[model samples]
Target: MFVRTATPEDWPAIWPFLHRIVAAGETYTYPRDLGEDRARDIWMLEPPSRTVVATDADGTVLGSAKMNPNHMGPGAHIASASFMVAPEHAGRGVGRALGEHVLEWARSEGYRGMQFNAVVESNTRAVALWRSLGFEVVGTVPEAFDHPAKGFVGLHIMHRYL
Candidate 1:
């Protein structure tokens, strides 16, 4: 698979899985019924921020990630990112590749660290992946997320110094 910076045209391919994942309400903190226009506004970030997609040899988009400053002004040295993988493409290393790519991006862009602001604690796969990639669970807000299957769950705040 190859990872590359995403263009506006990539949204057509990204929207379907993005919609499915967010609507599932099991992982992301986004509103379950989030509409396309709003999702676009959130996911398709502008420059200085970066967005990317992972694709197969045939150019089928398998996953996507967006990285940006965790806060503005004085807090801008810290970075944050979000990822989404196509359900059919899970377990194929697409998420790992995206995660690695984002880290490289953060380092190259001179970020001091990366923080994941709202990782769903029950999403063990993601939690594990982030841990394996050197992120630590700094804290978790008790019952911070309304999970569809698990009812209420914690939201993990993960961090790693670049």
Candidate 2:
């Protein structure tokens, strides 16, 4: 699979899985009933920030990511990102590929570091993936996330230097 910039036409394919993932309320902090329009508006970012897709050899989008500054103005040197992979494609290394691509992109763009502000602690696969990519849990807010199946869980603040 290869990663590339996403087009508006990619939304239809992205939304279904994004909706399912968010509605599950297991990991992401997004509202369980997040609508398509709002979701699209938030996910399909523009220049200075970017959204990307990981697609197969046949061009089927398997996962996506959005990346930008972790904060505005003074904090713009620190980058941040979020990712989602189609459930059917889990365990296929899609997330790792996206992580690597984002890190490279941030480095190329001269970001001082990359941070993940709200990673659900119970999402072990994701936590492990980020760790494998050199991120570390700098902090965690206890009971910050209402994980559907895991009761209240901590939200990790992960970071890594570029």
Q: Which one is best on lDDT?
A: 1
Each prediction's Cα lDDT score? 0.97, 0.96
The TM-score values for the models, in the order shown, are: 0.99, 0.99
Where's the lowest-lDDT run of ten residues in candidate 2?
Answer: 146-155
lDDT of 1 by residue, 1-162 (tens): 999999999999999999999988899988899999999999999999989999999999999999999999999999999999999999999999999999999999999999999999999999999999999999999999999889999999999999
Candidate 2 on 49-142: residue-level lDDT in tens? Answer: 9999999999999999999999999999999999999999989989999999999999999999999999999999999999988999999999
TM-score of 1: 0.99
CA displacement after TM-score superposition, residue 110 of candidate 1 (Å): 0.3
